[model samples]
Target: MAQFYSAKRRVTTRQIITVTVNDLDPFGQGVARHNGKALFIAGALPGEQAEVTVTEDKRNFAQAVVKRRLSDSSERVAPRCRHFGVCGGCQQQHASVELQQQAKSRALARMMGTRDAPREVDEIIADNPWGYRRRARLSLNFHLKSQTLQMGFRKASDKELVNIHQCPVLAPQLEALLEPLRQCLSELKAVRRLGHVELVLADSGPLMVLRHLSPLENGDRQKLEQFSQTTGVALFLAPDSETLEAPGNVAPWYHSDGLRLSFSPRDFIQVNDAVNQQMVARAIDWLDIQPTDRVLDLFCGMGNFTLPLAKRAASVVGVEGVAALVAKGEYNARHNSLKNVTFFHENLEEDVTRHPWAALGFDKILLDPARAGAPGVMQHVINLAPQRVVYVSCNPTTLARDSEALLSAGYQIRRLAMLDMFPHTGHLESMALFERI
Candidate 1:
């Protein structure tokens, strides 16, 4: 039995009520209004009637879990993964693909509001339904009393860990190595000191980075080497903040397009390679850059888009806050012989209106910002009114907020599409094309 961390409160069981789900909340939970108060129920699809047991009651709304389905929606499908409810990794595995896409479109539309919403929504880009995840961070916990290693995602609404034997979303190689890894860890004395395991599947093979709090003994090192030899997965050790070392002949993971991009186990890279390829192609296609066009690529990391855009544009300026990434981007540009691209390291969050580039006219602009969105960059965008702007966002709410700002700045949304970069989840990747009115 798993031990769950719970908040202190009085436990009261309310009467089981049958409610018809009317819509979905932002997190994809089915929403139903009961007696003028909103009820957010998990495992209940929109348009379906279900008996729910209220788990949490709040001032404005209540949360419940489906006790029994009275009427099922056609959109509800049998979830493929057995760990769907226990693991917090996937939220919409029970929803049909069509229904999931519709829900995402509706969510995006609601965020953008009716005035400046996309006139037509494109079909959500779906990839492999299973075994598509190429990167994952699995939390590690050792129960000394049970003498067992616990590895997997955290439980929903709780801090308890779910010891998953096999994950449907992980690549087959990584999935097959899970049990062996657990067994290996069980034998190691340093298992108690292990905090987490970061798994990265490159084009070549899978690599395991063990995050440990203490140094491993020689016997533990031998065990790791034996496991790596048997499983053919490279083993890396992150013993402390300053040290990261690989035991055997493990090469660095390099993701390449026109130029090779190298990063340590810690650097950020899109997990899904196939979808990332499509996303990059889509962003470039939407930009519709010309040879004479001058472009500005904001929040550029290692020249993912900057180098590609440099191939078409007259000159592309890439700005990134991290000096290391900016240096890497410059090296990649030079390695690819992309002479038209220039990298600048600056804090984009600060005002750049007084910068020299603020006066340098740019015909096209492309922004791929983090989840916080690009409010600071938006001001610069308003100052430097580019003829065409392509915005790629991982968060819908921030995208909507920035879209509203751009709309007020006399930019009309020309095209918008959602890419299902992450499947079986509520996360959305959206791209919008804005042209100056």
Candidate 2:
């Protein structure tokens, strides 16, 4: 039997007790177990001693805030970003880049267990430590008393907005337009109706997408257009799903890898351009496609990887759930003059065995499924029996679950590497190569 503490009872009060951090949790918070109960201490690094004040006490674990750093880890460093704590965007900014990679790698290794894991872990794929984000979602809040437009990310664990003047993680061009955007929004009468603003950077320029709950008047539209023309930022309005319109001469712009990949503002694309390029290169390298090899890409979006794979393989088939994206993907393939690639629209959530494309044999397979993972597509991989499988994942838990399924299907994980795609934050991107046993 275990003893329990009551919520009304104060277990510890301002007790300046020194504790050593055991490790960091998924959220980059330091983890330490005290009296068989876990304590998640913020601003503390692993292998370091810190004085902490308990913020919230729970039956199983407690949460605390660090008061003083008695001893610091070698990996501890001053954060580079000004809005590091207030923005809640980057959690590992205080930790060294090398230590951050090590933490991510250790997390992946633990998730995949050591029973039959690979002996050699691939080198970490690094990206620009700052100003690499190509897309961002900025919240919009208007204060009735102050008559000011508060635009930025929400503070951690609160609805209060941070109101950032500049973001180091965003593209330089987009970051430079933050104050201009705030000024433009502040001048509009319909600014109160705008709830959020999303920025996506294409090769041509930055696109500013505004999410407004109410219809904009003519004057408000003119304000947006003037801002767009003055700052050279494209403006997009989103009052509803059916009401996605661009005002003025603003046209859709896209970022590509020498291959056309036009997408709507709502579509999902990798946020870090440099890291994505490296990740794509790594995925292609792991494929090791022979000139005669046929490749099949699952959950392919906008032919990001499909068109690239087509260049190396004899034929490539891409499957996606969104029909619009499939059409764009096919158009991209055609524009790139890659006749070897074909895009199909199918609901991968349902059974894909009956699909006509499933009958086609493939030599190599690549999967970049969403956070839910490819649970419905795993059995199909067994049925297709591709010689090699390359999987890129964003969720480690789901990746581990899917990896176990692949292992049961006689696929052995050969190599794996972590890409610090979202550096500063706890989000991790990983790539794994599995060979048919």
Candidate 3:
């Protein structure tokens, strides 16, 4: 057994200590107590003995990094990616996929105040834990010293970019483009001007968006086109545009559940395709739509759920904050020949309860808000008097905070489960069904 030391032993900065991890933080860092205060260590797993060197000391807690693992947790496993520990993109890769899912569920339950409150994980919607990411935004760093380009995700604990030759988490097709991209860019006369790259596996095929700080020379442009042709991946250029949509003809889309959702490359879409299908099916099933029921979908980006929900309900209305996404949603509804769906552009965070759609009153409502959450929009939902509300959350903290408002408004949580939308990462996406008490 590794020796343990109590924090009362005159803790000091830069001190080395051995501690057994008790739990994991939401970010997947190990948590332990010392001298009646909590300490966090990265790369440490619960039930493992971590030899750590303290990096930061505060009145209540400390932050440390594991210098060595004296004993490993049974649930821990080898991460598949070479960049697992260094890349900030993934945190829970060191743990088994099963353990990762369980931890996420526990975190969600605790955050929602339903910990040990008797709600079972009716179904854990998940898919392949590796090679599932279809979209990735890579950092571009040109190393003049080596006269080479470094493209990858940022480092785990800092903004420094980690050069990656290959990534296992990205879709195989997208993953194949990394080396080719680096090689082709190295041949360019103006490689140093490159800023960032966004890769998306569009319905048509793989699409790569090359962001450059300045205009590309004709020779460099030809090289990019050659690279795209060689890889069979569509190449789009971004002139330092933040939205990342280069003016061109590619309208990327994805088909699922008898609907085709089209959106800009920069728009938000669920990463795990297999799990996303399951999530959509589960959401619709939980809503229990009736032919006469009116359904309202908030934050409807490109009609991911609205189109499918429209197929079953008498009428479905989708409201989105982004006008571009609203337009895309309308186009998707029209393209899919789905007649019962109507999309409106509205900022749900604002005082839009008076929106015309609210006057119609919905039988059920679905909310798929961003990490910032719906932001006190339950009042509007209550006023609409929807018999049921299904919330799909990407962040538990925000969901938990909003649950308070929902509970106060007389809503009862009927079902809750965590969706492993992002496996091998600490990111948790949850779905909950609430019925009026």
lDDT of 2 by residue, 310-329 (tens): 98899999999998889888
**lDDT string, candidate 1, 1-437, tens digits:** 99776777546667688899998764669999986899999878899999899888888999999999999898889888888988999898888877777778777766666666544555465677678788899999987778788999999869999988888888787788888888998899888889998888876578999988887899999999899898888888888865789778566555555556655666677877777777777778888989999999999977778888898899999998888789888877777788998888888899887777667889999999999999998977977889889998999889988988899999988888877777778788788889999
Please say which candidate is ahead in lDDT: 1 or 2: 2
Residue 258 accuracy (lDDT) in model 2: 62
Candidate RMSDs in order: 4.7, 4.0, 5.2
Error of 2 at 253 (Å): 4.3
Model 1 clash count equals 0
Clashes of each: 0, 0, 0
Off by more than 4 A, model 1: 1-15, 57-60, 115-119, 249-251, 254-259, 354-358
lDDT of 1: 0.83
Q: CA lDDT of 368 in candidate 3?
A: 95
Question: Tens-digit lDDT track for model 3 on 118-232?
Answer: 4555567888888899999988888988877888889977999999877888999889888878888878887788888889997778988888888888888888888878787
Clashing residue pairs, backbone N/CA/C < 3 A, model 3: none
Task: Extract clashing residue pairs from model 2.
Answer: none
Q: Is candidate 1 or candidate 3 better by TM-score?
A: 3
